[model samples]
Target chain A: MDMQPIVRVRKLNAWFGAAHAVKNVSLEVEPHSVTAIIGPSGCGKSTFIRCLNRLHEEVPDARAHGEVFLGDTNIYGEGIDPVVIRRKIGMVFQKPNPFPAASVFDNVAAGLKLAGIRKKALLMERVERSLRHAALWDEVKAKLGSPGMSLSGGQLQRLCIARALAVEPSVLLMDEPTSALDPIATKKIEELIVNLRKEVTIIIVTHNMQQAARISDRTAFLLLGELIEFGATSEIFTVPKEKQTEAYITGKFG
Target chain B: MITFSEIAAQGYTKRKFKNRLMCLLFFVAALVALTPLFSIMGYVFIKGVGSINWSFLTQLPAPVGESGGGMANALVGTCVLIVLASIIGMTSGLATGIYLSEYGRGKLATIIRFSADMLSSVPSIVIGLFVYILIVRPMQSFSALAGGVALGVIMIPTIARSAEELLKLVPASVREAGLALGLPRWKVTIWIVLKGSLSGIITGVMLAIARVAGETAPLLFTALGNRFWSWNLTQPIGSLPVQIFTYSISPFEEWHRQAWAGALVLVLLVFSINLGARFVFRPQISRD
Candidate 1:
């Protein structure tokens, strides 16, 4: 692990009213590296990532108490704007949700447009770059004027990826990005995620264990809102330290 | 025992007969529902279309003993009242909807939601009487402004609730997606949430407008029915419903015919509005 990780978490805790959703856990994600968080349902993988960018606060009874540092700045610090933090750490959701009101081109351009980027040529270039980055440009380039909803599920997911990347965020949080997609689409997205690591740091939460081994430089195993294991992918997969981790990896129980 | 094929064939025949009977019954029910509307439209067209000339449309109402006058003032008055009322109605209704759906929570939201439901269910005449007390008595004179205020007030709760419901139909995921991109809350609500529900919201607006347009009870006490052409908002103005009411009640036969003509025009106006609303908002449904 690098001494100065791009994202560092310390004693992170979250609750949905009385239900503790994310337990006290700490982790660090190095820059331009893929860190996969793998877990079963209700394991707080989504909640943990959402906390990274303050998206978890949108829930009615959801609350987080933790110190999350983006570089040297404590993201959860006083006077730190969550909106600014969100801009810096773009998030893709479990479900592909592109704006139905916006066209394919407009959907990618939406983030930039919201950030007050008015230069038409710059928007065009960035939109193109982002789409290319998500590996969706060639398929959707001809019909960019069509509504984003008109695209296939995979294409829409890729469109969402492009939308997130358009803002040029330093970190990207994806919560089960390919869970809703078919195997072929999932493969495409997996490839895109691998490629995207060269530009932006990525933290992907996926249920597929093979996916973790395939893409992640390092992997964290979360269970019942607690971090059970965090280590290099090869070491964790071949030689497990925790019995629970081994059981989960071997499909003894989820 | 009968063979299996024979039994199956007999059952098929019975089912086909039942299906045809059900289809015929439904057709009859539809005809029964539509008969009154068609007859009323047919009667009005036969009687009123003759009365609806350029002069009848563009001229003032004929006096009690006079002829050759038009509902020109009434037409313009109705338009003005509707235009003013819609502006007042839709703006507040939209705002209320946004609050109710997005910001309204706790006891206040409950009170507001309850208030909206109760207000919409209030009888239009009761609303008229209430408006009379609120505006007409205070103003000391019947004004077009007061009439518009009544209609506008009547529309607010219905529009508010429907728009709120439509806005709620917008998936939370879409809203989350936009906010995740760092868009402001207002932008997420207005540009994304409201825009996504635009067609449905417009449908609500249209339904509310249609509801308020044909109402005579509210306008009876407020606008108070003008006899002459008047544009000033402070003065009483003629409206189609009120004109139809007055003309239909009088002993004068020609006035009765003119009233029928006015009813025809009003029906067409509202019907077309509803029809146009469907067409305008259809693309929204298809997109969804």
Candidate 2:
């Protein structure tokens, strides 16, 4: 609890053309902890996480005017590469996006291969390790040669997680990774996330309140592009300071 | 008076009858649409396939009144022309397509896109005349190079627009996934976005090639046809389409038969290219 934060944001704002999406949001994520971002739909929770890796600016009209620090370095400083920044902060999407044309082994090894790791032995080792970390090794080991898209939805999601993990990133950002999953699959991913928290700082944007409460140590509530409250997960649930937060948590209104 | 149920049943029967009648009408319309196409194929196969043999493929056109001959020079020239044109076309087309789909914005992309669409609709004969004045006249000769350049010019707009549309089908998420891996934007575009739509791009390329295979108007002015086997690209060259036009209009019946044989070869060449492309893409299509 006393550890220094691995990621910090100060007055971060995102704009999609003329429309402001994330306005002056700031938070800190300590290493080896899971911080859940909770919000209703269209609340900029997804946009906020996207900014952490500088991915929000991919759209031609989308721009970010804010400071995000990974470790001690500001990611948007002059000559700082977004590609390099993203390498340290890996991301998993809401819907599973395993490379359709690649094999299961190649999908897990995609990021590593891009980084120029061509040695077969080294690739095999890393792929196996990443798959194990994502808790998908045993299930997919025999089928490593199969096309990545041939897997079930849950397995594809896990393969994506495995792909993200292969690069050995410092922070893992997930945007509602389990929203597309069935209950049993969601439970499995939740369990995997809990197990994964020991090695990296995890920040997850989830609309499911129970999921946030179950998996996160800290929770940040966002509404209409504003961060309304941030607190320890237990206290946020028990003694919410904002009425809007209380209303949202109690299901009185989204 | 009829009961309410009986009235409802009569209405249902009337609607059902209409539906059946409409289905029959659609079938008849479909047959009408397809009959001409099949008849053309049937007629061409019957008339042309007989003249196609090994010697007809390998031998040069018989001297004036002789019986045995082949479009050997034309076949080879068509290949050289198409290959040259494709090389020129694919380079410009793919580069322009990449710019149109991924890079350019504002007024420039719109202008280029509009111009490409307009160029594709221009008549091939007009394009041939334009090529004749611009290239063949300047070069001071009707050469295979000029002919290839003409076809290449025609290929650019079609291939570019097709490539652009196909590249656009690549999901934004795929770009994000590639960029997230720390690869540069251009590398992600070439390796991921372009690779993802490669099959579609190839389909476009094949279609463009096929269209040029049957075009005679462009070659009439640019290549100007040769009587002998000539490999010199800077000199006049024989091409199948031009040969077909020349022989079909000739006074001799034997030349007409040779033209039919040449037409058969051209059709088979195009058909095989399309079939070969489909064969190559089967594994790609099997993927989810």
Residue A57 lDDT in candidate 1: 90
Off by over 4 Å in 1: A1-3, B1-6, B283-288
User: What interface RMSD does candidate 1 have?
Assistant: 1.9
Question: For candidate 1, what's the RMSD?
Answer: 1.7
lDDT of 1 at A137: 98
Q: All predictions: root-mean-square deviation over Cα?
A: 1.7, 2.1
lDDT of 1 by residue, B104-181 (tens): 889999999999999999999998898899989998999999999999999899899998998887788888888888
User: How far out, in Å, is residue B72 in model 1?
Assistant: 1.3
- Give, for candidate 2 chain B, the lowest lDDT window spanning 10 residues: B279-288
Q: What TM-score would candidate 2 get against the native?
A: 0.95
In angstroms, how far off is B259's CA in candidate 1? 1.0
What tens digits encode model 1's per-residue C-alpha lDDT throughout A76-178?
A: 9999988888889999988888876678999999888877899999999999999999999999999999888888889989999999999999999999999
Worst 10 residues of 2 chain A by lDDT: A94-103
Q: Judged by DockQ, which candidate is best?
A: 1
What docking tier does model 2 reach? medium
Interface RMSD (Å), each candidate?
A: 1.9, 2.1
lDDT of 2 at A59: 80
